[model samples]
Target: MEFMDHLHSHSGLLRLVPRRPFPVTIAPMQWYRLEFHMANELGTLLPSTFNLSDIHVECSLLDKSPAALSSHWHIDWQLLLQQGAWDSEPSLQIQFLIRPINTSLPPHLPAHLMVMVSPTYDGDNSFYMLPLITAPFCLTSKRQTANNLVPNNRAWSNYVTQHMYRGFSLPCFDQRYFLIRESWVHGTPGKLWDSALVISDALARQLLPLNLTRPLKVLDLSAGTGVIGLLLAFIGQHQNNTMLDITLTDVPEALSLIHDNRCLNKITYPRLSVAPLRWGIDKDIQAIQAKGPFDVIIASDVLYEPIKFQDLVKTLDKLTTPSTQTWIGYKRRGLKLEEEQSFFTLCHPRFQILDRSLDENVIHCFGWLGPHAPTLTTSLPPCLPHRVTGVQIFHLSKNSPQS
Candidate 1:
């Protein structure tokens, strides 16, 4: 029975990795090719036990297009069992080609590719859709080879991403825009984190009434592109009474972009700076403390990986003071419940968790006007909530007196 399970393992799940890194851009009216290798882990152990029935590959542009173009924009390939047993080998190599088309596709759009395989044996039927690739790319005027470009090199370039927030900062301003440079092209700062928006919104509302007259010191841990920190700075500027001195910290690879984003925003009212800090490192902790204890710490989407959970908790322990307020926004990705519980368990010893339930205070704080209102004139457009889900915001503070 165990041997049969081994043979069928390749049928239910496909082990696929991108042959090349993300952001694979290509030109319009030119042929584009993509290559990938499929893992055949069990083929050697039980080659005769199962048979490969079919293989299917698909590529499509996810962005909205004209009805005529959108309907035919996708490319697909299907292969049958008569094509021979391609799965008998230890690994299978596949390539896809996109033929030239007349449509004028815009630049900076993302193309998604998915592959599924079906295998049958001993009168059993099953299919596997193991690997899905989302490569955010654009159609350009000039042709280029997709595989030649390295994903990591683009991370240091001037790739900019923009985010808009409603009813942020001053009540008079209906909306605000933030331009961020993504240091990691594979979608660290490259992607806009929804949790960042929710946490920033909640923080602004909760702190508005406090009205601290003095300059408020703030820190953003794992601050990808410094979105939350930048929002807090904007809030401080609008509050008139509180000045927010902001420090944005992340891995060394991300600091270059964080500094560039701070400059792009033209922020001057509240001093903004960047630091490179690896979580749980003693020297890094001491360097951050040189700026003194922060009044508020903001983090978002930093707890996705389980291995880093302990280090993150230690970093938080080092940064929090008696009066420090910490706000965290997390989106639960399936399969990490243990990591989430473990994080809170470690945090329970030193910090008290504030209730995360969304009430009228949190909702009204959005100040979203009706959909009929002008884009920039409304605090927030009504449609924002529809796009937000599966996210929770937590507020925490030290339970004991500061040493």
Candidate 2:
């Protein structure tokens, strides 16, 4: 917990780090000071584990191109103990330094940094650290393919993907919801968030009570990797209770990914199905509606583009039934509070906001059917803001006579 406290104090470091000039060199002995603190109390007891808190580096710019600047840098850091006893040797516990051929290349700005400690039989746990970042730099020359711009370096791409996947493993739920995934197919973090597995977890947990007699019919809109639907299927299969019928729909490009994921998960349930469902497409909407009133509808991080938002809302209005509960979770990106408020206002007349929570820049909204559902505003309150995000629950009853 002490480490967690220290990290909380330095949460600003989690933001994207600006790209500096490249090709500048640094001495072996001199490196920017880096500090790390274990944020998980349990991590401290784990053998050969360390948590990253802050990273600092110094670099100089070498060449400026239309797309990016190139620079070299040096990094130094102190290792904080999260788990197991440190070796008696001073070197084992002392601050260490590493000087990788740091290149701050243009167009590739750092977004977020990740550090992981992997234990080995002979040597101590090795630290695999990577910074997740991107910059918008256009190429001056025309390119035929994405690979033409970047070299064929799978290592860097894999490293970035692994970093993102780890973020997905972090705890982002309460008792009401928990993410479930049988396995990651593409295993890319950036794509995972787009999958909205977290939202599906929350919806499944909320609807569990309603599925006492028969299997729950769940619909996942904009399904990317099909993580949400797969997780629900896994839960249903394991519990051996009610059957979980899942229908996943997305654009063609995303549908292919969903199909591969479904196959990768070895899903054989008669109720599990995947199909293409694009917003604003009449055929897609009708096909989705044919599935009938699903008990739960889950969508996550799908409200970025303005056009897509309107299309999505319109599609929801047509597909949702009085008995269906729709849940939407979005990470705050370019969308402003006013825009979000406007969105809610437009939907408020049709769907009720039953529950809401904002944590780690992510907003979760639970909506139910009916016109007279209760409108509740729950805040985090300053005291518990650090621990739990704002949690609000809303309810709409289709059976209500007033509706």
- The C-alpha lDDT values of all candidates are 0.52, 0.42
List model 1 lDDT by residue over 1-403, tens digit each: 6655433443332333333343345544454343343432221232343344344443333231110123324443333223213443433333333333435654343332222222212223332222332333454445344444555757622232111112122343332333333333535754345566556656666776546768778888888767778766655655554466788899888777666655655555447778888999989989998886898888787877778878988999999988998888776544346768988998898899875635445432332221121232354432233112345667888888652
Residue 33 in candidate 2, Cα distance off native in Å:
24
Q: Which regions in candidate 2 have their CA more than 4 angstroms from the true location? A: 1-190, 194-197, 200-211, 358-403
- Candidate 2, poorest ten consecutive residues by summed lDDT: 366-375
For candidate 1, the C-alpha RMSD (Å) to the true structure equals 12.4
TM-score per candidate, chains pooled: 0.53, 0.48
Tell how far residue 354 is off in model 1, in angstroms.
Answer: 2.9
Error of 2 at 316 (Å): 0.6
Tell me the lDDT of candidate 1.
0.52
Give the number of the best model, judged by TM-score.
1
lDDT of 2 by residue, 68-166 (tens): 122232234554332224443111111333333444443322211122221111122222121221211111212322243334754344222221111
Candidate 1 residue 56 Cα shift, in angstroms, is 32
